[model samples]
Each structure stands twice: as C-alpha cells, then as structure tokens.
Target: MNVLKDVATGVGLVLATPVHMLGRLVSNVWWPLKGVKDEIVLITGGGSGIGKGMALKFADLGATVVIWDVNKKGADAVVAEIREKHGQDRAHAYAIDITDREKVYALAKQVKREVGAVTILVNNAGIVTGKPFLEADDSKMVKTMEVNTIAHFWTTKAFLPDMLEKNHGHIVTVASSAGKVGVASLADYCASKFGAVGFDESIRFELRKMGKTGVHTTCVCPFFIDTGMFEGAKTKVPWLLPILKPELVVDRTIRAIRMNQATVAIPRFLYFGQFLQGILPPSISDAIVDLFGANDSMDDFIGRTKKD
Candidate 1:
C-alpha cells in the first residue's frame, strides 16, 4: 500500500504538470496583465527614452512609481509627467548614481522610509560607446561596464533584501539583444549587457535554492531601439530586424513583469537566433549576421550627445 501511494503521487504530478502549463498559457493569452496595482515600482534611468516610457505606463496602471536617474532634471521631468497623468502622489524622483553602490543603498533606505518597500525593481540604466574595440577609450569601456552591468548588481543588492524578507518581489533587467550576440562596433556595450544577462540568471537560481517561490525575475533582451542611444543603427532587412520603438518595448516589459515571465526577447526573432547560435558553426553564424546586416548596423553611429 505504501509503494502504491508513492507511485500514485508521482503519476499525479506528471499528469498535472502539462495541464497546469496549458492553463497558464491560455490565461496569459486571455488575461495578460495581472498584479501591479498599488505596488511600488522603482526604475533606474527613469528620466528619458525607454525608462521614461515605462514610468508613464506604470503610473497609468495605478502603481506608485519612483524614478532614479543621475540627471535629476530628466527624472524631475518624468515625475512631472506622471503627476499630470495621474496625480502628484503617484510619482517620485531621486537623483542618484546607480553605479555608486553606497549611494544606491542610501537612496533605497530613503525610498523605503518616504515611499514604501520597492515591490518591483527595474534595472534599466545603461550607456554605450559606439566604436571599434581597438579604438574604444579605456575610460568609456569602464564606464560602460559600470553603468550597464555593475549598476544592476548594486541596485539589486540594495532592494532585494526587503523583497526576500517578504518573499514577494520582482527584479527586471533591460539587457540588449546585443548581449545575445557580438556586434562589430559595440564590443564594450555588448560585454556589459552580456554580464547583465548572466547576473539575472544567477540571481534567479539563487531565489530557487532559497525556496522563495514568490520572488520573480524578468530579463528583457531586445534589439537596438530608436531611442537616441542608438541613433543610426539600421537593419539590412528592416522587416526582419527593425529598430524597436520605446513604447513597444515598454509595453512588452510591463506585461512580462505582471505575468512573471522569466525572459523575453523583443519581436521573438532574437529567440530563434539565440537558439541557432548553439547549433550553427562559427562561420555559418558569421554569415547569417552579415546576411542580416547586423554587422553594419552601427557603421554611421552617433550616440546620444547630451549626458542625460
């Protein structure tokens, strides 16, 4: 009888797993956006471009939004827009450098006291230097790593403790599709984004080991956006790999977080490409990249001029 009972339990789980997954797939399609109301959402680099767009969307959903940016002016502008869309209390802004570990922790404490525990943490701050690896300045490379990759570590450390304490929180990383594959002129930027992708994967496993079922992680890897950061990037096949729009990225990101998606590649083409990387030979992969114009997307690069 004991042996029969154990067998029955194992069989039941095996049968239920597929049913549960199917149900979830249907639910995601039918009822996409969930949770998020009244949650405190903290977004780094929330002043402009994709960050600013996400802040507005969060406010529209009734979440208390916090914007953190090195450029205080840009953060303030976002807060102002949130206020107009929702109300004064719906949004807040802080001027702090996420690359500075000490400052990130300090601001986290302040935000906890003034706003509330951050229920959703978005590590979206990033920078790029569009130049060949040999011509790239050493300082620019270091800063790229600092802002694009290291900042995620510091921000997650500062806010993750509270989330773990409650066993309920979400961490979202805005990595790039460049993180998935190498680009000719974006070597430093690609390396930092690759780090971001690896970091998120490790953190997700850590949560699983700790048996923290309620904590969720979402990592987004998208192609270059039309945001000023990648002003001149273009695809050889526009329909296949067009530059992403900020609004589209923001919409997908918010939906992914609400639905607890683990990882998403914008347009879904990149997902197939990443799969091919594992099976295809190096020469074939290089040919595919060339055929798609990924090799020359940055030939006329002129990144954002203003420091913001």
Candidate 2:
C-alpha cells in the first residue's frame, strides 16, 4: 500500500508541474485580484516615500488605511489627504517609534480596538547609512538594523495573531536589490535588507506548514527608487537598471499583493541577474558586477536628510 501511494504521488507531480508553471506565466498577464475593500491595512512609515504612496493608493482602492510614522506632522498630512477622498473613517494615523517594542504592542491593541483587525501589514519603513563600513557610526548601524529588520519582528508579532486566527492576511516586505547583492558604502543597509528578505521567505514557509494558506507574503526587491530617501544614488546602465520611480514601485507592489505573488524583483531584468548570480562562479559573478558597475551605484549617495 505504501509503494502504491508513492507511485500515485509521483504521477500527480508529473501531471501538476507543467500546469502549475503555465498558471504562473498566465498570472503575470491576467489573474483574479483579491479585493481590499474589506481589509484594514497597516502601513509603517506611511508619511512619505513608498509607504505614503501605498497608503494613498490603498485608500483609493477602498481599504481602511492606517499610517504609522515617527513624524507626526507627515503622518497626519497623509491621513488628511486620504480622508479627504475616502472620508474620515477611511484613514487613521499614529506617530510612534517602531523600534520600541512596548509602544508597538500597546499601539497594536489600541488599533485593534479603534480600527478593525489589520488584515494586511506593510513593513515598509527603513533607513540607510551611506558610509563605508569603518567610517559609519556604530549607533547608525544599529539604528539601521532596528528600523529595517528588527522592527518587522515587533510589527508582525503585534498583528500576526489575528491573521493566523482568521487564516487570512498579506505581509509585504519592501526589501531592496541591495538586499540580494552587496554594494560598497552600504554594508549596514545591505545586512538589514538581507535579514528582511530572509524573514519574508521564512515566514512564508511557516505559514504554509501551519496550514494558513490564506496568509500570503510578498518580498519586493526593487532597484534604487528616485524617492528622496535615496536622493543622489545612481545606476550605470540606464536601460537595464534605471532608478525606478516611487509611483511605479508602489503600483507594482499593490498588484503583487492583490495577486499574491510570493516575490517580485522590479524591472524583471533583475530576475535574470539573480539567476545568473547563482549559477555562475563567484569570480565570474564578481567580474560581471564589476562590468556593470553595480558596486559604484551608491558612490554619490546623499540619502534622505531627515530619517523617517
């Protein structure tokens, strides 16, 4: 009976593999998008840049949007803009340091009581210290990790229980291309983003193992975006790795969430780069990177003046 079961499993895999691949291909062009009208979405760093862009877009789509940022004025402005279009009940804002676990937990309970359970969480807040490893301050490095990586733990802890109970939620990690590959003068940023990418992947597996298939995860790895957060960054190959626009990144991220894409590397070319990176020898890969000047992309880096 065990032998028969193994044979059946092999046959099922053979039949399903090709169909699954085809479905994935078709999904890029056309997939039934999940609705957000009934969702309560919590966005970290929603005062500006990608977070603010997503907050506005989600509210326009009819989801109740919650903005969290340390900058009270910025967060309030975003909330007001959203409320103007969707009505006051459609948007809310909170000013709190995400790295403070106690504050995050307290706010989570308050949010649950005031606004419904957060059905989607965007861990989009991040910071960068654009300095060579030795020149960078220890405090800045620690802060970078706290904001870009550690905060995910607190935020997820705050909201994931409700998701697990309901068996429905989406967690979006706004990682970066720097997360996938190393760049000079951004060692701290790279390390934090790498942690974020790994966190998203691991949680995805855990959710599947726990039979919480309704809870989805999307890891977004986009090249340098022109949001003032990365003000003076540059790219060598304009056609291949042009600095992306915030609007384009936000739109793609929203689409990925609605379609439940597991991971999306912007411009699609990055996909090929990642594939090549894995198959090629390290020396050869490094040579390719040198040829493309990937490491030099941040040479002129003058990152956001005021940290989010």
Candidate 3:
C-alpha cells in the first residue's frame, strides 16, 4: 500500500507539472507584487552597479532600503539620493565590510534594532579578478571567493534568524553566468559563483525541509553586464549572448523576486545553454564554449577598482 501510494503521488505530480507551471505563469502575469512595500530590504554592496540599481527600485516600491558597502561615501550618497527622491525615511546606508563575518553579525543586530528586521536580504556584494588562473595572485583569488561566495554565508547567517522566526522573507543571491559554465581568465570568479549557486540551492532545500514555505529565495545568474566590473569583456556572439545591460538585469531580477522565482538566467538563452552543458560530452561542451568566445571573453579584462 505504501509503495502504491508513493507511486501514485509521483505520477500525479508528473502529470500535473505542466498545469502547475502554466498556472504559475498566469499568476506571475496577473499578480501584483506580493512583497516589498513596508518590508525592510537590506542590499549588500549597494554603493554602485547592480546593487545601487536594485536599491533605487526597492525604494521606489516603498520598501525601506538599507545599503551596506565598504565605500562609505558612495553608500551615503546613494542613501541621500534615495531619501531625497523617495522621502527621508525610505533609505539608509551602512559602511560594512561584508568580508568580515563578525562585523556582519554586529551590523545585523544594529539594523534590527534601528531599521527593523530585514525581510529581504540581497547578497549583492561581489568582486572579480579578471586575470588568468596562473596570472591571478593569491590575494585576488582569495578576495574574489570571500566577497562573492563567503559573504553570502555570513549575511544569510545574520539576517535569516528573523526571517525564519516569522517564516516570511526573501533571500536573493546575485551570481553570474560563470556559475553555470566555466570560463577562462575568470577561474576564481567561476568557482565562487558556482559555490554561490550551490549554496542557494542547498539552503532553499533546507528551508523546504523545515516547512518554511513562506520564505522564498531567488538566485540570479546574469551574463556580462556593462557595470565596470567586467569592464573590457566582450561576447563574440552578440545575437546569442550579448553583454547584458545593468538596467535590464535589475528589471528582470526584480520581476523574479516579485514572482518568487527560484532561479533566473538573464536573456533566457542561458537556460538552453545549461541544458546543453548537462547532456553534451565534455569535448563538445568545450568546443561550444570556444566557438562562442566565452573562453576568451576576459582576454582584455579591466575590472572595477578595489574601492568600487
């Protein structure tokens, strides 16, 4: 009876999968955003680039936005701008070294006391070293991992308690396309992003196992954006994998969050690319990457400054 019941359930879900997906698609189109507006959204690395762009959008939607960045001046400027445009209480900024776990915890406590429990945590802080594997220094590689991957671990540890307590919150991880597929000249970045994608998937499963269904997570993997971080990178196939724009990335990201999507690949083509990677032989995958110039996209890399 147990085996029969289990098989029946499996068959039911398999049969219903398309219907369920279609319903979800309709809901996404019809539903007004169910989050934000009175929620406190904390965005790490919110000084510039994608983080800053997301901060503005969150503030526009009436979420009290808290920005954490190593650059005090840039964070403060963004906070001031958001306040000026969206009213004084709509935004706040903190000079936080996200790489430091202790500081993350301490500031999280302060944020809870001051700004209220953060309901939306965006692990947006990231760094990249565009040097090839052998050419990249130890510090650069370490910093890349610390900022892009380890910071996700720390920030989630800090803010996730309140979220779990209420069983209502959202976590967003801004990873990269490198997380899905390997790339030359960005070995460290690829590793860190892959780690992030894995982490997000694991935690999401943990949440489900714990019956915390209300808490949602989204992992965003975008292609190269003109955000100064991947400054001189180029895509050989513009039609297939053109460099993403910051605004477009943020827009898609916000939509994903609003709809409670698990993971989203920018431009949507990467979904097929990931599918190809899964079944193709290693040699064929490598040949495809070489043909697409993804392996050499970072040949002329000039990444952002340390302070940025």
CA RMSD for every model? 3.7, 2.4, 1.9
lDDT of 2 by residue, 17-69 (tens): 88987997898889999989979999999998999999999998989999999
Reference-based lDDT, each prediction? 0.91, 0.93, 0.92
| lDDT (10s digit) by residue, model 3, range 1-308 | 99999999999999898897687679657866676899999999899999999999999888999999998898899999999999988899999889999999999999999889999999998988889899999998999999999999999999998999999999999998999998998899999999999999999999999999989999999999989888889999999898998999999999889989899998788988998999999999889989999988888887776654
Off by over 4 Å in 2: 1-21, 306-308
Clashes of each: 0, 0, 0
- As a whole number from 0 to 100, the lDDT of residue 75 in candidate 3 is 89
TM-score-better candidate, 1 vs 3 = 3
Task: List ranges where model 3 is wrong by over 4 Å.
Answer: 1-17, 20-29, 305-308
Order the candidate numbers by lDDT, best to worst: 2, 3, 1
What is the C-alpha lDDT profile of model 1 across 1-308, one tens digit per residue? Answer: 99999999999999998897687568657765676888999999999899999999999889999999998999999999889888888999999888889988888999999999999999999999999999999999999999999989889998999999999999999998988899999999999999999999999999999999889999999898888988877788878787888899998889888888899888777877998988999999889988888879999998897662
Alpha-carbon deviation at 166 in model 2, angstroms: 0.9
Error of 3 at 278 (Å): 1.1
